[model samples]
Target: MPVQQLRSGDHAFVSYADDDAGREVVTTFTWTGLARHEKVMVFSSPRTDESEVWNSLDAPGPLLGAARERGQLVVSSMRALIHPAPHFTPERQWQRIEEETGRALEEGYRGLRTYIDMHWVADLDADIAVMMHRESHAQHLFTDRPYTEICAYDSRSFAPDVLTAMHRAHPCRLLSRLGELHVEQTPGTVYLAGEADVATREQFLSAVREGLLRTADERRLTLDMSQLIFLSAACAVDLLRLAAASEDHGIRALCHPTGVRILRMAGAENMPNLLLSEVTR
Candidate 1:
């Protein structure tokens, strides 16, 4: 089947039983759809079967040639065949995957189109959800391009928890030091990852309220509490209030496992948007 007509910044996932077929899809999507048309951004997964795949595309001369010619970007992955139910509990495995995915996104695509192609089929829903969330939420994934394109291939079912954790660990540069703020924009959403006290929380709330008031457009907002080591009842209230204030804007808050217990003690049922992890590797 031909690759789908994806939006300019949409992620395009190409999955096939044959390596040649997968390579062809990537080539067509980058060369014909993006390069030739100059109207779309493409991204594949980090797991592909072909190592010399880029060199095989003669029409584009080189993968970079097509990109330079059309003023777009093409991204692919190293050869990795992962099992659908394979265990990923190892700490190093997760770190390796994150590192590889991060490097691919940063160096392969030079600000044009973004492409990602996973070589194996794990959890379809989780992979796609993670891809969408990361490409849309994390800022450092694309150095110059501010758009997102995430595609996932699946030959099986979906695991919500696994997907959520994957999204949490979707390889973005961590903002070090407490109280530092980072504004991130992704497809269909924006997130603010930082640390803060009561005062900073209030400021964030104000910014969020203004964002909601100023745009009337629905957006998903995530407050990453992965770094927050301490909490107070007042801070919990501030978070809940933030969620309540931005309810109309589709804003949601996320915290780590410890944050969950703290919020619960503070009388908050932080569900749906609270991304919890089974194992922190």
Candidate 2:
């Protein structure tokens, strides 16, 4: 899912192939939390320098410095966090997180969020079984609580089986980044922006499918494509088929002239439940 779609109580997992790819999502996660008045904590990998994390978050402006000065943003490591404990234990770590969440709430923040690089597992020489157990059983931390977390796994560090297992274990999985296309959503609408061509066709379909499922019982589902720069013919056909399949619900698409033309050519006019509105500036 897009990072923008993540909300409180979402425990998301993301795996990255390199530092650049990893930083892309973490940067957005950190800044978004700060903007939402949520205390943000980043636990750097043992291999990463604290200064590098600080520089990445502060790239656009001095806002990160100000946030740090006020204690809204913290960049630290797992080793330091579990201090006074002789070794890594799930109970000990979870206890500290609960305490931190309470501290954030008491300090006048809306909530607390943490981005933990999974390299800490190796750094602490923790047992793989114990870590996996912790990951699968950590739902208690998020249930009915205002804490959000992202567990990042470095693809190069962990084996394929381990990565796949970890991915399935998490309740939420985050898209690496919103590269060429962006999808945003509300209760009854899914907004598509950027280009939806052959390359991004799958993503477009997935987002639209999710929106349809969410609004299945409602009278209408809106696809706001006012900001979409380009729509391919194949994608238009896919949209038409989806609308045709969901006979009971109406699909309303707000699009520019180009998109309208593509859909019209793809037989949008024949689908009774599909409504297309031309949006003009």
**Evaluated with lDDT, which candidate comes out highest?**
2
Please state the error at residue 36 of candidate 2 in Å.
0.9
Alpha-carbon local distance difference test for all models: 0.44, 0.88
**Residue range 148-177, candidate 2, lDDT tens digits:** 999999989998988899899998877765
Which clashing pairs does model 2 show? none
lDDT of 1 by residue, 40-140 (tens): 33333434323354464444455366454543443333223123334333233234444544443465442334344543234233344544454345444
- Count clashes in each candidate, considering only residues at least 3 apart in sequence or on different chains: 17, 0
Off by over 4 Å in 1: 1-179, 185-188, 210-215, 219-232, 246-249, 270-281
